[model samples]
Target: AQQQENSEKVAKAQGEQFQSLTQIASGQADIAKLQNQYSSYNIRNGMYTIVAAQSGQVVKAQKAGIGEFVKEGDMIAEIVPDDVKYAVEMFVRPLDLPLLANGQKVRFMFDGFPAIVFSGWPDVSSGTFGGEIVAIESNVSVNGKFRVLVQEDKDDRRWPRQLKIGAGAQGISLLKDVPMWYELWRNVNGFPPDYYQPASGQKNSKTSK
Candidate 1:
């Protein structure tokens, strides 16, 4: 009887020890979970002035000046890499939107630079450089115009190295190549040049795949 009683006491002690250890382990897990949630909140809200993932020069800062109200999620800065390729952005008339397609060749005449541009004769263009339509934003911009992105043409002259961002450039998307004499005759006859129309089964510029 004494041996049985001793064994019962031992089993009860072991059960109590197991219960205590389980409670301790559960408490530690709760602490770890809380710590992880705190860390995640700090990262999402940015504990410090946001750190850039890559090293580069900040060309512009969009922060408000001193004494100005700062808003959450406002841009902190604009960083440009050391070796950046530039592209010109131009807004197109809504009526001309249908004529532009992906990879369509364009001619550019930069403002503040002199260039005698012949729309139909891009090959003989003097100061004008070549580009191609890379992107077209259907969303309307200022004055109800659509935005188009143009990049350097690999087959033609390169853009001027001195050109800076925000510089204005007039662009013309060339379509439907024709004989030079036919263009001149059309101009002389006061005929408006024909716009490009894709035939059946051709990709639509507005919805080009």
Candidate 2:
């Protein structure tokens, strides 16, 4: 009887040891599964890779540096795309506002390409190309100057490939198709041309002699 009791106790102890080892093995597998899930989530969230929406050369870097901290939606850099088209913006003096109009001819000589000068009348000048006035800002700038947009004259000549964007340029636009004497007279008298007409419902006020 004593031998039979000892055998029963030993069997019970062995069963408890096996149960404890099984629980430990299950816990380890659960931990490994959680680690794999976390790694997959990190990859999907782009924690290791960053890609730009469009391909372009970075002109200015705002926050892209090693060991730098950046939040979501923060601007990393300024990129000028390769396919971007260039337009010239010229600031016109307030005094010259009356002489400007859309569709007028414009000539440009960029500082980068100083050897070339674009003129409205190519027959009278060398190295002259062509452009047209596209828009004129209604409001004046802080410096009392108005902005004008000039586009390349596709019908006349194409813009040079060597010309760079954001380059400073000296632009001369042709005034209204009036006589030279009239332009000179207006300049001497300090009179603004009738470029802007009164509204349809408004009447022109004139002092009777």
| Best-fitting candidate, scored by TM-score | 2
Residue 20 accuracy (lDDT) in model 1: 100
Write the residue-wise lDDT of candidate 1 on 1-209 in tens digits.
99999999999999999999999999999999999999999896785465787877888988747645567877878987666677888888887787677677777889888998665566777788788777899799977999888889999988888787788898776667778898889989987566554234776567556
Query: What tens digits encode model 2's per-residue C-alpha lDDT throughout 17-58?
Result: 999999999999999999999989988788656677788788
The per-prediction tally of clashing pairs is: 0, 0
TM, every model: 0.56, 0.62
Worst 10 residues of 1 by lDDT: 195-204
Segments in model 1 whose C-alpha atoms lie over 4 Å from true places: 1-51, 63-74, 118-120, 179-209
The TM-score of candidate 2 is 0.62
Prediction 1 TM-score vs. true:
0.56
Worst 10 residues of 2 by lDDT: 114-123
